[model samples]
Target: MAVDNATVVYFSEQVVILISCGLSFLGSLLIICTYILWPDLRSTPRKLLVFLSVSDFLSASSYAYGVWMVFKSDSVDCVVQGAISTFANTCSFFWTVAIAIYLYIFLVKSNRRLADSWVLYFHVVSWGIPLGITIAAVALGRIGYDASEVSVGWCWVRIQATDHVLWILLTGKIWEFLAYLILPILYILIKKHIHRAHAALSEYRPILARNPQSQSPSSMADLKLTFIPIIFISLRIWSTIRFLLMLVNSPVRQNPVLVTLHGIGNTFQGAANCIMFVLFTQPIRSRLMTLLCFCCHPSRDTAGDGHAPSQRGQGAETPFLAEDTP
Candidate 1:
């Protein structure tokens, strides 16, 4: 017998979600490990990245677990998975916005101490609000297995809830939408500020003479920041579209291709972040490469040790994470 389209779509969505969540989990884990292994890489920005990865790690893992328990829709584990995913995913969105705000304050406003002063606030808002929302959702009995009609292949808000829309907004969608709006505007403002700073520097050649390399790293950092919002928006737009369709009770919301795309997009954020913040980042990648090379060529240990003294002195003075300026 030929397989029906519904069965084919369901199987495809499950496979895509599993693979995407697996990649995201591994990528987030790598970032967490990198942070733990290298104290030198623990700058303010990198510290924020580690926190973001932690949330992504939880979000992706919970999502994978939800997919695994998709058949057990009414089980307690299903509700637990839904709750955890909601909290962690919301935290991820908040942390992303927090990073943007940190960049704006540090680079655009030139606030050198904002990271130290504002990190507590960032944590309280990013983690605390999600915790509160998740608790309320659980208390109200909103989280459970959403069937294929509502979700791709995971647990989330119950379709039968009288106030499902309200819970959805409180749990995840509201923050996701806010991030979509806030990130682009903040990044654009930061870019314009950098341009103005560069223009001013060009007019005042003496400043450049004093510190010729002052703006180079900032420019490079700006280039990296430009990709962040783009990656986030691209990966998230599919799910957002699905959500809007569901609100209208449109048949297109259940289209297999769209469902697969939504599942992939929802679970692939951590992997995308890993590619952007780890693989493509020069400072972290260089350090990772050097460590790998040293591990592979242990026979050159003596030669490497001989230069350790000078390397240590230079490393102490070098600013590996000084890309925060404009």
Candidate 2:
């Protein structure tokens, strides 16, 4: 009777999470489609837009696993959903940190060329390092079984939270949360300062207002990107709250409802960053529209199937004048 009741509750929560994941996924796809199809959107905001779209896609993928296994319950096969859940969560955090670091280097570094090199390094480390760590974690978990098995719906390794293992995992968790949540807050403060400085400079030379789209921290589209980390932070908060309550009394270390919610929430965090970039950023939207028109309505759309930079340079050069004589 107790097992039966647990199953029923699991069934119901899974359904809710599935629906939520679907909605978030569809929304993310539409937004990405918009950004990719437009050229004006991609030129200046290209790198950042790419980051958001990738984040959203990963989020959607993570959510899809939950809907497939959790809500449907024992009816479906359970793969490494726990591992995936762990990977996606860690990845989403890292991506946000990448964006923040990118913004920081761009705003602070006087030499654009050196900062550009650092940006490439950031991308490699951001993308490459997390997977290595996760593999180590999962291997560690499997070498010595933490618990009976990996959790029912989760894709990653589910180890028994030994005092030592928990401490190590918690250390990583602290860094993840700080890098995503705390560093972004710092970025905002720094951005606010830079914006003020830019505003002051504009007073002296009006032409400074017509700066490169890439230089500005908050573009017309970037406001959306800026708001998304805040949502991810909220997800962490909800997870933390439920976790604290569950921690004190429970030995099993599992709650179907909370687990379902956290999985869905984390996925949404990944997808939201990308979708928000597409929907909220003007450059992405415009570029995507143009790209779409070129593909679907080639006659109507004049943007040829060429590279992103050349087109962007042409579009951008109009705003600034040629070099002056010494």
Candidate 3:
């Protein structure tokens, strides 16, 4: 029994997608639960991260829906999958941008907290924009958005019409290009600002050390915090590059190994965020552990009460989210 390469690749892609969906679903769910149960994680400064987590949660769920649709294929299901996945994925991208902007303003530009009203602006831009784009694109697809084709495995933006460039531009390439441009610039600026701040703190370490209560927060911690966006952009860029390569060289898509790797990187996008938030963040991990212990011992009277830092430079109170710019 000689299985064709196409058959092997198709099966491998499905398996990889299923694994990615499971990892993303559980990982995002744990993050959501950790945030919901821990009141300390719900401060105003952390609202962006909370919003981002919600977006990732939806994205993961959408991926699962896409997988289900593969089993029960229909024209309506294809359209619905495209609409839902596009909207959710777009929100995730915008949320990441919002976080980057928030970090830049709070960490590099000024010490002041973002006004509470700013959250309204973030939600409007992040959610509202995606809603509009998804509606327009899906509506147009119904009327023959040529590049908006659905695969049996999943529904995503793919070029079906080599002659009609408009659909390809609107589908995903433009947004991906914007991401490629914005993320690198932000990353460089953030790293530079952090390094400069660390040097300034070192110069005054002796003075700060004399007052144990007022010691400067660890720059290394801040550096580690910046790695979240770095890793995110890196993973996304890798997937995007492979996608572009596949578009140009369709034969490469038949390679099961490359296809599997691409599925693992792209489909598990939410899982990456979960690992960063739960594993890399000390405050969240501590809170999560306490919650688990309480669940295990229902009679334990000690419900761990703690405060997370609302802003940078708060001694001994590191952020449970992404605020690491002391």
Candidate 4:
């Protein structure tokens, strides 16, 4: 009776996960489609949008097989959890690294480079490197793979008490720390130096009076534009920590509470980085709104009437009149 009840719960969780995944995927698709159909947006967050789409794709694809196993347990053959989890975690790690590196280069290098083939090369290396390491770890006889009644969601790999899963986990935890912590801090510190320089310039000019050295048009081109990447980096670090906690030694795995938290947290990370971050930006959001309004009302897009807003127009107005003798 207990076993049957557990299966039922697992099934319910799978349904919830699938629905969330589908919605998240739709959001990614919309962003990608906007880029495909529109030319203006191509200059904004283009590389970022690509990286995010790829990450969500791998993460979602890996989990789908695991979700399937919950419904048809026997259909899961060899360590599906191991394989899928491998892809998800790797993309989570490697791709996060790639983004950090890309951002840092964009900031310090002074020239943004975009080419059609760049995305293709990025996909190959980012996907290939971690995949090779994952396969090697299993094949080297260092880590064993098997399915256990411990969880239905894990189709490919689940580490038992004796499985030394914690050992493999600890190594990853260390590497993840290097990728998630040190690199972001370095980027922020470098950004601070640049910010300080710009703030100094604001002293000599009125346009920058309130805040001259806009973090935008510098390290970040727009405050609204930059917010998404900042959020992505923050979430990447957060998810890395949660992943470490979910490893073999975690007693939380046995808790219904931990299991649900793990599933929800993972899903949330995947969805936010792909959807909310991409769509909430100034350019992307503008394009998305235009697309939606055009599809529905068709005649209702007045977002870019080609006039700057009143406040900006006022800011541009000069206070210098034909002055009395200085």
Candidate 5:
């Protein structure tokens, strides 16, 4: 039995996107809830995760809107959907970069302390920059600024025209390259600096003995922060490469295999990020377990091991430290 290629693409796009978006939405919601429900999790570094989670949640919601727009097409709907998704995507990337930079300073630069003002500044830049980009693009698109709608029944900037292509190439494609390519480079550079620092410490035997048990939160946090970009880049790499291929040969867009691959890869990003954060970071996992225990045992006065939040050991830290140098 020969199945039509068109039928395969149609099925894959609909089913895969729906499932991915649904999982993404659910995962993002859980991340947000976990942060909100537990006050103990609130910290300077965790603030970035909260921001990133919000962006992912919005991204998933925007995808859901795009899926709905498939059945009900309207130009206004298309523009709105494109704008929201673009903003979410842009914010996610910048926030990821910010996290990396923070870790670089903390680990490689040996600067564990970040001022509150500095953290706030990063937050503002992450959220504000994306807002400006999205608004300008949406306004330009509505005013015949040459941006065209794209995506399989969903709305996104078209890659066909020079101006329309710039919208994505600048915001979306560049960020993908930054995360997928430049991040690993940064990781290597930072790791080398850390090794040098460790060697320097070895020269002072007495200092090392004084803090034999004093583990550096920077190292663990760096590992955790680095993994996030890798997870995101890995999940989206297939779709991103396919997109580049489409730029060279537009007809490849019609290939059902590529279409399905792109659909699954791009849509799965939020879920992948959430899963990695929850599973890889022990702090998040332990807090989640505490949350679950609290939920299950309503009569319990304390959560997980009965240690007071303030008394918890600072020895082991989450991917983001609760006691970042303020």
Candidate 6:
């Protein structure tokens, strides 16, 4: 007996989505926990990352719930999952763009304090717009059981709605597309500004010798920041392509490989962020390693390392926002 195409697609989509969402949830949760546990890490940039992780956590958990609800075929649960996932996922996109904008202001504009002032506005836009769109989508009854013909093992805008395309764009796709456009442009500008700043600093190197505290931005930090847009676009482009194919009613949209890729790409964002910002960040990783060492060896003198874990609340340097430190 041979397995049919539909069976293959269904199984692949379900498994991939479930696993990806699980990883996303875990990754997002870890970021959130790290933020809460270490007050010193709560710099402006890290706060923005925490907000993004919050949205990712909700989106991933809701997607996993949507997968479970698929089995029950419960219409109400499907709608709820669709609404929550849409709201949270859109917020994630907004927060990602917020991070990019914050970086641009901090790096290019060179107004660090003023850049920090935008945190309130960032919260309002990132959370408020998504909430409004989700409410409108639910009011119009546009979100429900997105059949296997469209979604991977989750609920989203119903395929049956007359305005489903509009709802899809409003709920998530528009913001995602905007993030794709905005993140790279902003990061590129920041990179160019950093390079220019470095060139200018080189010119003043001898004069700056009198001021030992004067320092230029970290090129390594710029390199790490550059990865933000790359990872986001890489993990999200598949879903965008799938959506375009679906819009054209292309048969390739239903291909198991494409569907699996779409599911994994759509759900892997949180994990990608974890890998980029948390594990790859020197400050956070070093702190985490210290904590782990302390936990594993209770008798060891943590203070002997010259950085006591208790001092984490004293606003230590995070340098995650492309500051002087690398």
The clash count of every prediction, one per candidate, is: 0, 23, 0, 9, 0, 0
lDDT of 2 at 191: 52
Question: Over the stretch 112-216, how does candidate 5's per-residue lDDT look in tens digits?
Answer: 565344677777888898888777776666312111122444567643335655776655777767777666776666666655666463322322344444255
Clashing residue pairs in candidate 5 are none
By lDDT, the best candidate is 6
- Sort order, TM-score high to low: 6, 1, 3, 5, 2, 4
Return the TM-score for candidate 2, rounded to 2 decimals: 0.66
Off by over 4 Å in 2: 1-12, 23-45, 48-52, 71-79, 142-152, 157-172, 200-226, 250-261, 286-311, 314-326
Better of 2 and 3 by lDDT: 3
**Model 6 C-alpha lDDT per residue in residues 126-234, reported as the tens digit of each score:** 9999999899889888888556445676788877677777888888888889999999999889777766786563323432343445344434455676788898898
Q: Candidate 3 residues 133-241, lDDT tens each?
A: 7787766553121121222245554334343245544555566577667766776676677557755634334334544653444433444456665777666664565
- Among the numbered candidates, top TM-score falls to 6
Clashing pairs in 3: none
Candidate 3's displacement at residue 192, Å, is 1.7
Q: Model 5 misses residue 80 by how many Å?
A: 0.8
> Which 10 residues in a row give candidate 3 its minimum summed lDDT?
143-152
Between prediction 1 and prediction 5, which has the larger lDDT?
Answer: 1
Could you give candidate 2's per-residue lDDT for residues 1-326 as a string of tens digits? Answer: 12232222366666766676676666666655644554444322245445544655665666467446443222112324444545555655666676565545544443435545766665666566656765766556532212212223433333334443363354246555576556667557645655667545332132334446535555532343356466667655545543454345353335665665554564555345544544443344455566767779768644644434444544221111111000
Give the whole-model CA lDDT for all candidates, comma-separated.
Answer: 0.73, 0.48, 0.58, 0.47, 0.60, 0.75
Q: How well does each candidate superpose onto the true structure, as a TM-score?
A: 0.84, 0.66, 0.77, 0.64, 0.76, 0.86
Model 1 CA deviation exceeding 4 Å by range: 1-9, 199-219, 302-326
Clash pairs, candidate 6, are none
Tens digit of per-residue lDDT, candidate 4, span 1-326: 12232323355666776665666566556656655664443432354555556666565655555655553232334444455566556655656556555544444443346323355565776677657756765564333232322333644333433544553453244445666565556456545544655555331243333344632443222342244346545544433444455443354444544455444444445566544445444344555566666678856656544322312322112110001000
